[model samples]
Target: MTEYMPIMLDVRDMRVLVVGGGRIAGRKARQLAEAGADITLISPEAEPEIRELEAAGTLRWLRREASEEDVDGYRIVYAASGDETLNERIAEAARRQGALVNAASRAQAGNFIHPAVLRRGRLIVTASTSGAGPSAASALIRELDERFGDEYETYAEFLYFMRKKVRETVIEPETRHRLMRKLAETDILDQIRQDTFVPWSETEAAAWIEREREE
Candidate 1:
């Protein structure tokens, strides 16, 4: 069994290739495009959703089967042509081109796997079963999705702003660490849950850090 190391990829504006035109391929293309990937999908014909995406300027759809050379220059490749043999061939080409690949038809043929992902503003959560099965991973993602709600998005953004403020204003390392920790330990989340969390302004953040520094 292959032990997969979990990672958060920054695929924004990265070149990606999706070789397929069916539901699975459209799904992959949609996800990649949503993540800000520059995608070029190769297939003789694509599903309506993919066509819409192309029309919207989200991704380019090439009307043809993918050749090995198509995998070149792409940072990531998704081989989801719905044909096991074709997927394997695409995966092999991706490997030779030094591009990461996700093969929908056969996971073992690819070097990487897609995990269930949930995003709440700055908060990103992912779950993977490492090839055991997707059902279990999806179940875990659902549970976590419910556990973390929209309020968390605001909470995360608030924390990020405060942390950056603290880093910029506080010169003392110890005080900075203490203030950062205090921000995390604060009851802001409770207020957020209660719909009472007031966003901190730059002046407010600075004043809070100053008061903490005095203590």
Candidate 2:
């Protein structure tokens, strides 16, 4: 088995092709659509959710079997036709077209694999078992979801806002780096859990940075 490297891809508005009409294809299409990918789903028939998305203009659905030529001009291709042979064919076509392919039936046949992911605002946690155990990966993601609750969303957002403020305010590179680390190491998460977390405005953040400099 090939070792896969984890990466965060920015697929916003990227042309993507999904070859399948079953539930798996619908799921992959929905995830890609949510990430702002320009998706083209090729399937003779589709699940209700896929149809809804097509009707809502979220993606273009070609109601027919995918052809090898359909893989052209796509940045990413998902071969999820539920038939191993069809998926393999699509994967082969995608690879020839210099597109990254992910085969649903066989991860090894493709160049990439999807991990079980959990999102909390800007916080994203992903787990993969190297295609050996998807259920284990999902279970791990579920555990992480329970550990990092809704409060984490607000916490992460606050940190992101503060990070920008820190970069803009703190002039010294070392000081800025230290302050950035200090911000994450603070007891803010505890305060959030206790319902006492108050967001700092730009002025407050600057004041805090100045105080840290003094200390």
Q: List per-prediction Cα lDDT, in the order shown.
A: 0.90, 0.91
Tell me the tens digit of each residue's lDDT in model 1 across 37-79: 9999999989999999999999999998888888989989999
What is the Cα-based TM-score of model 2?
Answer: 0.95
| Candidate 2 lDDT over residue span 61-97, tens digit each | 9989888889999999999997899999989989998
In candidate 2, position 100 carries an lDDT of 95
Prediction 1 global C-alpha lDDT? 0.90
Q: Show the lowest summed lDDT stretch of 10 residues, model 2.
A: 162-171
Off by over 4 Å in 2: 171-173
Highest lDDT: which candidate?
Answer: 2
- Candidate 1 Cα errors over 4 Å, as ranges: 171-177
Residue 65, candidate 1: alpha-carbon lDDT: 82
Alpha-carbon TM-score of each model against the true structure: 0.92, 0.95
lDDT of 2 at 186: 91
